[model samples]
Target: MEISSGVAAPETRKCPECGSAVPVDERYADWCSACDWNVDPGAADPEPGRIAAARRRLAQEYGDQLAAEMERAADGGGPPARDTATVLASGISLLVHGMTALLVVTGVLLVVLGWETGVQPVIGVLLLGTASVLRPRPVRLPKDAPVLYRADAPRLFELIDEVGAAIGTTGVDAVVVAPDANAAVTGYGLRGRRMLLLGLGLWEILPPQQRVALLGHELGHFAHGDIRRARLTHGALHSLSVWLHVLAPMPAVRLLDRFVNAATFVPRWAVYGLLLLLDRLTLRASQRAEYLADASAARAGSTEAAVGLMDRLLILGSVEAELRRESVAAQMLGGRGGREARDRAEEGLWERLALHAGAVPEHEYERLRRVAARRGHSVDSTHPPTHLRRRVAASGGSHPAQVVYEGPRAAAIAAELAPARTSLARRVIRDLAG
Candidate 1:
């Protein structure tokens, strides 16, 4: 098998369990393909807390059911009907917001009626302050956050606008670059102006077309109308989560505190139950939105590119490991323990990552797919299983790219992102060193 430059060819080794020849790449774990030995090495990682474990289990269950349902719908040529769960979820969300509104009105009334009484006015102000604290607020970028404005990256913005137009939504107001290995779309400010968050770790490794596919998938969340992304539902969910956190029972350290903790137990559980119910109600709709987004990705970037994006996603763990390995190797070779090592690590970081991603062979992809299936892995608790999404992308049939991004325009976008690339790489290396 051909290996890209900077990556060594895999050495063959006998699988201890099955006696089968396994291609062992130093970049990845050695696993027996014939008998499926050591396929899921991640299983040995530390167990998650109870809530996270439960959420993962629930996500896996919902993903399986939704994948089957979506497949059937595709085959039958009929979309599933809107169900009561969504309506019920929306209603509950509205009620939560209504409660917040009630608090605001009550606070105002107290202030208006008892303006003359010092104690009453003080209580009224406190109530108003509490209401303000609980109010739903739009997301805001940090002042020092790295942002790419249209003027600075016109070509990139134009490409984004083209994709947005194809997906039936206005383009983003700005692009925020971060060090994460993920991309997302979110709204900011009171007007809810959209923004695209591009993670450099993921972006630096993707081909131009696959990057377009990633954009399509994220922007699709807006075009496809994900209820969870809607301000009303999202705000309510946030408020409820906050309520749950606030109502949690505290450890009793004294006699009076014991009584207080005891009194709060029922209310704490009540809030917990409500949050769980709301999550369950919205689960199916949120998952359906993901599938729809994948369809949009296929349409915008072509099915082939979308499928390739999924393949990239499947091996993100390996990508991350490789990045850390590079950082460590650079640090050791540099011989200096401080800024010099970090600078050495940051240099050629993106180039090395791109090559490492490119060097992943077809067999490795297949192995990751099998491991994903075995582990019931998804991008997160919110996303559907990656394998299922990949299948959907492939089954959507061939599609011509709706908005092409290549040549000089692509180079221009890269040029615009150069500063961000350097900063993000330095940040990653510094973090690893620390």
Candidate 2:
């Protein structure tokens, strides 16, 4: 009983909570739209732990406040004022980098003194090694990773450049295609050259306009001054994390080892406290960066496309589930393992995924939206709640598409991505089969 649009036909039913006539669909949950009963069935379950619950509460509170502030700023035709949290986070990052520099200088001095003054060479060498390991290292691409240079993907790069220009950023240097259900942009090497990682699982399902919105959102991280992504702060955070790991106490039965562990306890706790403080200071600013990025998405791809992108994100869980089911089906149908099963899995994968995405009914989308509002769900803890993001995106009236991707240009980009798509899809299917 499905309509031509591929949505299940609705049947009338009485709501148990409010006795209202609800339009019930066989393919989706039936909830009373009038009274909002059973809007979020999973709300009865407790959060994983107290800490997670507290974080959700905080995210909800901050999201509400930020949305209102952004709306007011939009009305006033001015940028939102910078908050103290970003400034404090930057200060802490500088202090951490300073501490790292001090360690490097101390290591050098120790080595020099040991050589010139006839002290223990071994002690100096160990300190020097530790300092070297703790030093901030530039980002590097993984060895033999599948990469698309501008020559290989000119149209795609051009499209990305247009989106970046719309949002006031220089486009990426390269593109990396992978199997994950997400997309991201990051810097690599000492000069911090930008790169885009496009996941086929997510990309294949997006409409052309929404794809532009996706690019705008990722590149927007750079334009929006996201502190977490900045080299100094990002490197400092990494150094502190590594220091904590190295200083952590180990299990020991020997008395000497136990004593050694006890000796390191104070320093370990100090580093732990510093890490916590730095993370807390930066959390709010990082969340705000995401909201601003959404605004960039709107600017590039129009309000409708940006909201469509968010809706796609809301259904990502279902998309991943479908991929898993397809993997199992391919393996079962193929019978024999190895190349045959892998081939079966990759064949027509994207088409099947797009079909599944299309079958998702409007009622299901409404249900997910209600669930997000009720649970304050987000893409991750660092992001504000998805519902809040949607509100902020829509609060600014509709925008015309600043960069369009359609017709021949869209086909050319798809053709360019064909090779990487096959490689990534094969890898994903192989991993899932195992």
Candidate 3:
């Protein structure tokens, strides 16, 4: 083993509240997503007394306010009636899919007619093939991939069921575990089946109730029909984009490409412009979805738990990047210690994260909330600022504390998947090494 002389590395800017590394490039942002810290030295400070008073008021009426909000939502008095944006987006999707289907059908009809009428229809056949390619590809999962099955992880499934019920959702079709520090709910298959993906890196760090809140938040998306609407908007946009890219003329064939591109320009631009407009129109709705999900999560779990989950997500990005760069990559660089090395590194990284995971700073949260309200999603942020979500969650109804397997039981659950987690960490480390 080669041991180098000890040397202190250059100091880097880090989010003081969350302890997450701040990229030199992104340091100018008004607020830190990690802990909502005002990262920019020149950022204006909010009035101290006003913020303190607001926080105190929030703490006092948080539960009752959220309960009333939830009641309003249940009564259909919350959130704009999904009309304007959904209609526009769904309309555009329908037009694209409809046109593509028509072209394919017309091509097929021409080809069939040609056989009887002795008219050449080669172009028609080609059009049919092109239309088929333009359609969205089926969602697929790799065979024999290491997924944490519901049967093997009964405790996890049970927890999901409990939280799902609380969030007004039914069964989850599948669950997948990976090494990252996050979780997401995705739609799978033609029938729109739901799959919950959990990151072991995040799971190991969170307490049991926090995990429930996280799950509740995700399941809320399903209950609120956000998943279905997203499939229509995002999925259609993705498929149409792929089609356009494939059909776009190559610069290499400049002379012929110009004519081809000119012929297709109008339709292509129309689709592109529609998607952009859709994003703009739905910005508020998208943000509203996040707030509503936070409410559901708070209702299912405790206010504290939902807030804790949001805080962790905001901060975990930097923590995750650091773990990949330092502990995981460092161990991988050494001679193969196999699964043992990966396990040790993972445990050590979790400990480090736990140490940094303290109470969220109040001033930081208030500053971020202000920044987010002013900035909106001009930066293409998928989710609303963590501060806003945190505030919304803080003002939610109370629930009995939920503990989903802890102590030895939690350890057993963790141990049962040691091999899988170790395998994933090694794979990630190898990828990073490259």
**Candidate 2 lDDT over residue span 1-434, tens digit each:** 85488776667889998899888776667787778887776544467753345556667768788788778866775777677876787788888888777766776777776686656466667767876877778877765558888999999999999999999988999898876678998999888888898988899888989999999999999898788788877877787888888987888979988998999999988887777677777767787788889989999999999998988898888888888887777767666676777697797788788888878877678888888888787886667899988988888789889999999999999999888878777766656756
- Which scores higher on lDDT, 2 or 3? 2
Tell me which residue pairs clash in candidate 2.
Answer: none
Best by TM-score: 1
Q: Residue pairs in steric clash, candidate 1?
A: none
Predictions in order: lDDT:
0.81, 0.82, 0.62
Instruction: Report lDDT (Cα) of residue 56, candidate 3.
Output: 29
The digit string of per-residue lDDT tens for model 1 on 1-434 reads 98669966658999899899998777677888898888777653343654456566677877667777776676676785678987888899989888888878877888889877757767777777866777889999756557988998898899888988888877899899987778999999999888899987788788888988898999999998888888888888888877777777667788988898888888888777777787778777888888888878878888888999999998787778877777677667667566676687788899988998999888788889997777766787767778888887777668879988899898888899989899888767756654
Return the TM-score for each candidate structure. Answer: 0.90, 0.89, 0.71
Off by over 4 Å in 1: 1-10, 16-18, 44-51, 111-123, 322-341
The model with the greatest lDDT is 2
Q: Candidate 3 — which residues are off by over 4 angstroms? A: 1-38, 41-82, 115-121, 143-145, 227-231, 247-253, 281-283, 335-380, 397-405
Local accuracy of candidate 3 as per-residue lDDT tens digits, 1-434: 99867985534476778887644332224445676566434443342553233332332333334344545665567644444666776787777678778888889888887776655478678888878777765554435335666778776677778778777787587777776777778777787777877776677667777877778888888877662247666666666666657656557467678887887788777655665555555544555666778877777767778877776665465457655675546566355877666556655554455554443345344444455444331112445545556665675555555435457656667666676676666565555445
lDDT of 3: 0.62
